[model samples]
Target: MANSSTNSTPGSSAREDAIRFYQIAAQRQPTPAETAAYKFIDPLAGFANCELKIFEKNSDLGGTWFENRYPGCACDIPIHNYQFTWAPYPHFPSFYTGAQDIYKYLKEVAEQHNLRKYIRLSHKIIGAKWIEERQKWQVQIVQTDGRELVVSDGETKDGEQGEPFIEECDIFINSSGAYNNWRWPTIPNREAYRGNMMHSASWPDVDYVTGRTVTLIGNGSSGIQILPAILDQADKIYVMLRSKTWVTPALANRFAGENGANKIYTDDEKENWSKDPEGYYAYRKEIENELNARFRLYLKDSQAQQMGKEATKKQMTARLSAKPELVNDLIPDFPVGCRRPTPGSGFLEALCSPKVEIIWGEIDTFNETGLKTASGKQVDSDTIICATGFNMGFVPRFSIVGLNGCDLREVWTQELPTAYLSVTVDKMPNYFVMMGPQSPLGHGSITGSIEMLTKYIRKLVSKLQTEAYASLVPREAATKAWLAHALKWMEKTVWVENCASSFKNGSSGRTVVSLHPGSRLHFFDLLEQPRYEDYEWTSLSSDPLSMFAWLADGFTAAESSAAADLSYYLVDAPHLKQRSRCAEEPTRATATGN
Candidate 1:
């Protein structure tokens, strides 16, 4: 019942601001005379309604948490830190809850908020093109029952019957996350394997992995967690590693169990959290402060980072003592935070088991039964489980064509996929993104920051809705300046160290492409207000004088409203304005999502 308040500073709450301007478009159309009245100004005059649509590829919600059901699939970030800042849940069973639990929690959220009405599950956006004449995006989408998609201008890649239909929108928001589309390892004769093969993302039942000899690839986040999870069940496991990586405890490990493993909550603890709002808020703030402060660990050669590395090494070395040689093969030479850190609970212990074997070097080829190593060593297994991760090279699952026939995919492919504040591109007008390249996800919690970014997006959309503006896109010079500044700041961080990372082009590249250079709080501050000066816009009215079209009538709708408070600005007002609620019908929308 508690934990509803967010942004309890001096003035209005961020949550209240978000609720007030929730996706509404201009209500009134201003006449030519009103628009041309340049001297007259109005902050809010013609603002009304807007429609929001969500296209989900899967049958259910929960993007990664629903898809990745691997043996030890759980959030590396604790549940408290991962939850929405505005809508914190009092009852999370564990600090690192499983995928199922996470999915169920999301499902409950959708139902409670009536979000499914705006969402079209089993729907996927195939392509998007900016129509200059209309100042809108013509988007193509299709309903799929989880079939293979082939988006093309001519024909389907498989010649399937699923033809995409088109829908036009004033704005297009892409939430197609980096890890949505997966790719197999580029091992020669990968398809020739007759043995059972499965990806960590597209995992089947745990029964399928039981009693089978498994050959695992990639020791990243997924690989790290899967080892100990299936160690006791599988007959034998051969972990294939291309390079070494550090396995460190999770952020805010003091709030978690030993070595930052999952900490289960007791019934009494849940009851206390549900009742004591201040106590729960204090606890949550303490955890978040720790999470934000740990950004210092990424500062190259800093005292905090050095101490962190040594502490992590001590923990990892002790755990790998049973097989001391793993210290050389498993630990990385580069500093911590070079690669994404995950607390691989019992992973080092699993390596000590006789049934588990660690193989060095990449898979040169895959045989009919298993893998053929670069040294011509034949590694046999009953099943090959490739945890070799997603195609996170910034390639889109669907095509996106921006202004002047500029293909966004080509731009990203040819040059670095940069953005304006990691939100929108140069030519992609009327476009916004949730989690894009160089986002605040490095030191920040992924899902938690998404909520913040959505508020920023909401603020931008409100301008287009209330103000009589056709569209606005980031300026080319502004984007370039932002990118250059980001790159410069990144050099001071540990991410620039020589390490094999998905963030870079490959093992040797020093450029960090995936994370924001600044801290989470810095990103939040940067996005607290929209910078309209750095953008190029076209007014809704094409007339040259219509540039001031937002000043129509020099009046605000609030002045006419019966429930509005005229003296709202006065400090310590005796009474606050109270507005009547909408009827049940319009308050709850059941329109079919396009």
Candidate 2:
């Protein structure tokens, strides 16, 4: 592994710094024996293949791990089941692992596969443009110190010098996980509150909840986790529910101890769970089968038949009413599974605490000290945490300028962002998005989805080298046809028609980022093999001039100059500066300016 002490050269462009980082990461010189392990496929028959570049936004990683540092913030997926089959966890433990364990497992994977050398930490992709002439992508990246660099030719460039620092790659992988970008609610008095307020993604480092009256906004997974922890510290804790949340009692949440629930199979339990082959193989197959079965049921909406579709709310209320007052505030008005169902932990125990309270009314506005609910009730609190999740409707912050200089966000403004199986885009060539639109798995482990996408990209890279193809993109017709099928499948699933989920059309007025309503197995089958016919392949030799034309036509010198001019005007304008600050900072006022 390369040493982490290397910093970007002073006065280097953001692109230059990116190139430096990429080079350092790409420095894993493969041995001849290792090179022989790669399978040469049809398209990439004779081309030289060496490295793979995965451009991930470090900010998203921070939000995923950093913001969600709640006490019980562990993964719901079983540890053994949450890993890639090819790269299984060596010390796979029983039961679902906590957040720290998941982070450790991810770090171990990066280290084990020598993936650490391929990651450019603290670097954010600012812009990516397709270079038609070179049949490559010109990716713009920003370093932590605010330097702008362009990476291509596998080298980094300092923007100030206007020299080529890095050569762009044959393929790009985006592994930005879901929920990195926050989606705040648009309720009354969202910004006017004077108390300390924070989003689940922006939880503070201090123990401010101790001896204080705390109000937690949102009742999602994070909300459920926080309720129990804060109840121990806060003098009075009120869990505010904007909409109803689905609840399922998982063994991990129900049983608490060093042993917890036995997710790992014992010799005796394994025999019973499988009743097939003896020993470890039986255990593995049993667990995988059980998870797959649940995934199938989730796709089929079996829960609706067992408990009734609308009956989820009433059933949940009754379940919690066994403890009284807890059900009054915890029960949501919306249908269950309208939002994702979180495993109900010691939230019932916390509500039973005399110091805790549940407020069901909507917020009217924020006063000088506390929140004023629409029911004319005043709830006083010192610290307020907004568990309000991310803005799912928004596309990633990365700027993607595609055909005719079209922006990706603009194209996906109204509809939920659609991609060819949540991987390729129509206008974007040689660019692959990891965990993109409609790729999230409602059941089963997300690591499975990540592994599938990574494998597909690996295969595509091999194809590019074999065919000696310069670039490959999904054909427009194929993209549309696939989306039609995906939508049709989604219509049958519960999230599409029954749920009032943020994953649906609740916040953005459109559902832009959710998977097809189907079993994870079905999704896995779709991505198990590469469908080459679904894409359009362009060779650098046959369309050499066209590649150059695309590059030349992308951003002209005049356009670059215009962008710079606009940047100057926007930066210097005093009024715009104030507006920018307000836009960037989350306010404690009402949702709307009522």
Best by TM-score: 1
Report model 2's TM-score to 2 decimal places: 0.72
lDDT of each: 0.71, 0.56
Q: Model 2, range 306-388, lDDT digits (tens) per residue?
A: 45334445545555665665665555544334466665556655666778677776777766677877898887889888777
User: What is the per-residue lDDT of model 1 for residues 480-581, given as tens digits with 9 covering 90 to 100?
Assistant: 999898899999998889887767734567887677878888888888888989999776665565454444344455554699787766756333331223
Candidate 1 residue pairs in clash (backbone atoms < 3 Å) = 25-48, 25-49, 26-48, 27-47, 27-48
Please identify model 2 stretches exceeding 4 Å from their true place.
Answer: 1-48, 55-63, 90-94, 145-167, 187-192, 251-284, 299-304, 307-322, 325-336, 505-513, 543-594
Off by over 4 Å in 1: 1-48, 146-161, 505-507, 573-594
Q: How many angstroms is residue 180 displaced in model 2 relative to the true structure, after the best TM-score fit? A: 1.1
